[model samples]
Target: MVDLSQYLPILLFLGVALVLSSAFVFLPMIAARFTGAHKPTAEKLTEYECGFPAFEDSRSQFDVRFYLVAILFIIFDLEAAFLYPWAVSVFKLGWLAWGSMMVFIAELALGLVYAWKKGALEWE
Candidate 1:
């Protein structure tokens, strides 16, 4: 049988991490209950610093264009992230990796063009 003693340090480290993390999370909440001011007033409870009273519901409809642009930004951003690691390893990985990355980039470019044609990128 493989000696389980080799894993003892890892198990101890995990146990320490769990105890410390739980303390960090719950200690603050326990302290806050004893230390925080227990007061509620009408003005204090209302939303602050808006000069006029809120006219519309806070959860209001947003432009679909905003979400489209956000999603495009995230997609392209993740593509760059993936490219960085591949770029660093490219010398060792050679032509196959390079060709694969080129295909990935071409696909992203096509998506960008499609979004442009669909007017998903237009602000106005």
Candidate 2:
């Protein structure tokens, strides 16, 4: 018999989480109904973004510069994500990890400089 007693705490935690999540999601809805605050108004339902109606086509083509910015953001964001875990354990990892991290940073720095030189950072 596989002794599943060791997994009892994990199962209990998951069960509690499920109950709390369900309560949080349903309680608000039930309270709103009972409190008479669930009335729907046309103004409340309208889009309030930019405080004006959207005049442009929703599917309009975006500029390449925006895409470039997004790609750069993702690249640097992933670098930060990788750096955090590596930073935490680099001391135990020794010189090879340190050297590799430095090389990775240098490559990213070079790419950033190249983008700067090419005016890819400019939004206008």
What is the C-alpha local distance difference test score of each model?
A: 0.93, 0.96
In candidate 1, the residue pairs with backbone N, CA or C atoms under 3 Å apart (3 or more residues apart, or in different chains) clash, namely: none
For all predicted structures, in order, the TM-scores are 0.65, 0.60
Q: Give me the runs in candidate 1 sitting further than 4 Å from their true place.
A: 1-36, 46-55
TM-score winner: 1
Q: Write the per-residue lDDT of candidate 2 for residues 22-43, one digit (tens) a residue.
A: 9999999999999999998999
Q: At residue 30, what lDDT does model 2 achieve?
A: 99
- Top lDDT: which candidate number? 2
Model 2 TM-score on a 0 to 1 scale: 0.60
Backbone clashes per model, in order? 0, 0
Candidate 1 local distance difference test against the native: 0.93
lDDT of 2 at 17: 100
